[model samples]
Target chain A: MMIPLADLVTILPELIVVSAACLLLVLDPITPSNKKDLLAWMSVATLGVCFVVTAGSMGDRVFAFSDLVVVDGYASFWKLLLYVVSAMTILLSIGYLKEERIDLAEFYGFVLLSLTGMMIMVSGADLLVIYLGIELMSISLYIMAGFKRFEAKSIESSAKYFILGAFSSGLLLYGISLIFGATGSTRLVEIAAAVDARGLDDSMILIALMLVIVGFGFKVAAVPFHMWTPDVYQGAPTSVTAFMAVASKAASFGAFLRVMLEGFGGMKPNWSGLILGVCILTLILGNLVAIVQTNVKRMLAYSSIAHAGYALIGLVVAGWVGTEAGVSAKGVSSMMLYLAVYSFMTLGAFSIVAILRRGGEEGEDLDDFTGLAKRHKGAAFLMLLFMVSLAGIPPTAGFIGKFYLFMAAVNAGLTWLAVVGLIFAAVSAFYYLRVVMVMYMREPSPDQEGETRLALSPTAFVVLALAAAGVILFGLYPWPLVSLTATAALP
Target chain B: MSVPVEFYMVLSGLVFIIGLVGVLVRKNLIIILLSIELMLNATNINFVAFSSHFGNLSGQVFVFFALTVAAAEVAVGLAIIIALYRHHASINVDDFRLLKW
Candidate 1:
C-alpha cells in the first residue's frame, strides 16, 4: 500500500503530539537544569495544540493509515479527555517534583508519548494497531512508575508492574492471535463481519473473546486480575499514581470498549455473562478491601478498581446493545462520559494526595486529613466535594455518570445486575464519607502541633478547583455532555 | 503432507503454558522476564503458523511487530530490574516487597 500525505492529515492530533515529543526528547539533555520547567511548559503547550486539533476532528468520520486507525466522536472524546489529563498531570507535578528533588525533564516527554499512545489506542481499528498502542502506553507507564530512581519502592513498583504487565500483554497477544485464527483478520470491522457471516456458535471465537476479555480485565484492573493495583499505587510517586489511576486506566477502557463492542458485538450473549461476573466481583472486592486500608493512596487505588468495575457495567450494557447505529441506549458512550467524569474526580482526589504534606513528610495517611477543615477551608471543602462525588452522591458528576450507567443497564434489561451494582454503590459510601468526617469533624492530631498550614502550588490549586467545578457544574447541568456522549457512540 | 494446524496450535499452547508457569513460579525477576519473552515467542509461533496455514501475510507481519515491541518491553523491563537491584542489592522478587499491603 502506498502511503499518502492526506492520510496523515486525518491524524493531525497524533502527528502534532509525536513531533512535539521528539522535539522535547531532543531538547531535554541540551537544556540547562533550571530551565527544565520550560520543557514542561512547552509540553503542555504541545498538548494544548493537540487538544485543539483533536477537537477540530470531533464528529468527523475518518479513518487513517489504511483504516488501521479510525476517527470519530468516540476517539475524539477520549483524546480530548486524555489531553486534559496530560496537561493537568504536568501542571500538578512541576512543584512536587522540585520539592521532592526528583526532577527529570524526560518525564514530560514520556507523558506525551503515553498520551499519544492513548490517542492511537482510541483511534485504532486494527488489533495490531491497538496492541502496539497498548505496549506504547504500558512500557512508558512502567518507566514513569520508577521515575524516582533513588526510591526503593518506586523501582520495586516498576519491576512488579513490568513483569505482571508483560505477562498480561502476552495474554492479550495470544488472544489477538486466537482471534485472528478464528476470523482471519486483525481488523475489527472485518472480524465483526466474519462473525456475522460465519455465525456466533464458533467455539474458537468464543474462547478467543474470553481470552481477550481477560487481557483487558488486567489493563482496567478488574477484580481477578487486579492484584497489582494497590502495591503499585502506594509505591509510585503520587503524581504518577494519579496519572496512572486516571489517564492510563481510562485509556484502557477506551481500547476495551472498542475491541469488545466493535469486534465482538456479535457475541454479546456469550460474553455479557463473563463481564457481568467480573463487574460484580470488582465492585464487591474493590469496596470491601478499601475499607480496611489506612493509606490514602492505596484506598484510592481500590476505589479506582471499584470505579473500573462500575465502568465495566457500561460495557456489559453495551454488549447487549446490538449493532444498529441508530439505537437509543448507547451504553458505551455513557461509559465514555463516565470515564471523563471519573478521570477528573480521580484527578482531584489524587491531586490532593499529590500536593498535601504534614510535617516534613508528604501526606498520604488518612490521619493527614484530620482537622483539615478547621485549618484550610477551601482545600477541605474541595476534598469534601471530591469524596462525596466519588461515593456517587447526588449533585456531583459521579452521580450523573452512575445514573447513566444504571439507566443503560436497565434499558438493556439487566436489572438484576444493575440492582446489585446499586447496593454496592451504596456500600462504597462508608469509606468516602469517612474521609469527609475526619477532615471536618475530628480534632487535629497532637503529634503535628504547629503544622496546620495547608500548602498548595498555584497550578495544583487550579487543577483541583477545575476538577471540582467540573463535577458540580456537570452534575447540575449534564445536558450538553449527555448529548455529546450520546452522539459519540461507537460505530 | 504438511503438518496439521491443530499440531501447531497445541505446540504453541504448550510453550505458552510453560512460559506462564515459569513466570508464576520463578523467584528471579530476570528469569521471570525471560519467561515473559518465552510467552511472547509462543504467540509469535501461533501468529506465523496461522499466517502460513491461511496463506496471508498480515498475521506474519503482526508477528514482526510483536517481536519488536517485545524487545522494547524487555529493554525497559531490564532497566527497571537493574534499578531495583541497585537499590536493594538483590534481584529476588521476594526481597522486593517494600510497598505491599
Candidate 2:
C-alpha cells in the first residue's frame, strides 16, 4: 500500500521527534562523553522545530494513517505545552546528570522517544493507537526511572513501575477488547456513535468503562491506583521525576480526556458518578497525607496526586452536565487550563527540588530547606512563589486553575463537589505553607552549617525563570490561556 | 464444530481473573511478569473471538498490535528486572522495600 504525502504531513511533528531521537542515538557513539551536552542541545533544538511546526498547524484538523491519528487544535495545544515541558526537562537534566555523575547521552534520546509517544497519544484517534502510544511512553519511562542503575532505590522504583504499569495496560487492553466487541469498532468517533445508538445499559460496556477508568486512573495517579507514584517519583532521577510529573501527566490526561469525551461521551451519566467518588477520595487522601510527609519529593508526589484530583473535577463536571454541550465545554476547557497551569507550577517546584544539592547531599528533606531565606533569598523567593501557587492562594496560577474548575463544577450543578474541592484546597495550604515556613522562619541546624552550598546551575536558572514568569504572568492575566483553551476544547 | 463466542468470552474472562490474582498475590517477580502476559493473552483471545463474530478485521489487527506491544513490554520488563536483580540478589517483590510499599 502506498502511503500518501498528506498523511505523512499530518504527523510531521511525530516524525520529527522520532527521527531526531534515532539520530541522537546514532550520534551518541561517535560523540565523546564530555560532549553529551551537545546531544542535549540537539534534542532541545529538535523540540524547538517541532514546536514551530505544531504551532503552525494549530488551526488545521486532519486525520492521518487511515484515521488512526488526528492533528487538531486540541492535540496541538497539548503538544505545544508538552514540547515546552520536555525542553525544560532536558535543559534541567544537563546540569543534573553532571552533578549526579551519570553521563548517559541516551537519556536525551529516551526523552525524545518518550515524547514521540506522548505526541502520538494526544493525537491518537483510535484505541489501538492510543494503547501503542502509552506503551511507548511507559516503556521509555521505565528505563529512564532506573538510569541510576547502581542505586537500589532507583532500580526498585523501576521494577515496581514496570510490573504495575504492565498490569494496568493489560487491564486497559481487556477493556478495549470488550468495548470493541460491544461497538464493533476501535475508533473513537465510531465508539461514540455506537454507544449513542445502543444506549448505556450493556453490562459489557459498563465493565469496559470501569476497566478503562481503572487503567487511566493508574496512569494519572488517582486514589487507590496511586500506590506507585511517591516511590517512583522519589526514586527516579530528579529530572526524570519532573518530566514524569509534568509532561507525562499532561499527555496521559490529554488521551484520557479524549477517550472519555469522544469514545464514551454517551456514558457521561454513568462515569461522572464513579469519577466523583475517585476525585473526593484523591483530594482527601492526597492533601491530608502530604501534610505529614517529611521528604519533599514524597510530599510533592502526594501533592501531584491532589492536583490530579483537582483536574478530575473538570472531567467529572464534563460528564455530570450530561448532554449539555456548553457546560461540558466549560468543563473540558477548565481541565485544559488546569493542566496547563499545573505543568508550570509542578515543573517549577520539582526543578527547585532537583537543583538544591547541599554539599553532595540532596536537599530532599524538608529540614534542608531551613533558613533558605537567609542563605539564598532568590531561591527561597521562587520556592515561596511555587508553594503559594500550589496551595491555590490568590494571585497565582494554581488558584486561577482551581477557581475555573470550581466555577465549572458549580455551573454543572455540582456545587457540593466544588465545596468539597474547596475544603481540600484549604487543607492543602498547610503543607505548602509549611515549606515556606521552613524556608523563612527557621534557622539551619548547627550540624549542617558551613558544609551546605546551593548549586544553582545556569540551565536550571533559566527553567526557574521561565517557570516563574509563567506562574506570575498567567496568574495575573489568565484570559489568554482561558481563551486559548476555549478554542481548543473538544467539539 | 466452531466454538461459540460466549464460551470464548467466559474462558478469557476466567483467564484474566486468574492472571490478575497472580499479579496481586504472587511475590516472585517472574511470576508477576508471567501473570501480566496471561492477562494480555486473555485480551488477545477476546479480540480474536470478537473479530470473527463481528465479521471485521480491526479487532484482528488490534490483536497483532497487542502481540507486538506485549513483546516489547516483556523486553523492557525483563531489562528492569535484571537491573533490580543486580541491585539486590533477590527477585522477590517483598525483598525490595527501600522506597516504602
User: Per-candidate DockQ versus the true complex?
Assistant: 0.83, 0.93
Task: List model 1 lDDT by residue over A1-491, tens digit each.
Answer: 67798898888888888788889899999999989999999999998888888887789788877789899888888888999999999998888787677878888899989888888898899999999889999999999999988988888888888888899999899889988998899999999999999898998887788778888889999999999999899888888999999998988999999898788877777887788899999999999999998999999999999999999988877776453443324678778889889988999999887777876567889888888887788888898999999999999999999999888877777888789888888888999999999999998878765674555888788889889988999899999889988888775
Chain B TM-score, candidates in order: 0.96, 0.97
Instruction: Give the alpha carbon lDDT tens digit for every residue of A1-491 in model 2.
Output: 89999999999899999999999999999998777789999999999999999998887789998889999899999999999999999998888888887768999999999999999999999999999999999999999999999889888988988998999999999999999999999999999999999998999999999999999999999998999999999999899999998888999999999999899988888898899899999999999999999999999999999999999999998888443789889999999999999999999999898888777756888988898888889989999999999999989999999999999999988999899999999999999999999999999878877655666789989999999999999999999999999999886
Residue A472, model 1: lDDT of 93
What TM-score would every model get versus the actual structure?
0.97, 0.99
TM-score of candidate 2 on Cα atoms, chains taken together: 0.99
Q: What is the interface RMSD of candidate 2, in Å?
A: 0.6
The best candidate by lDDT is 2
Q: Looking at model 2 chain A, which ten-residue stretch has the lowest summed lDDT?
A: A447-456
- The list of candidate 2 runs beyond 4 A from truth reads none
Each model's chain A TM-score: 0.97, 0.99
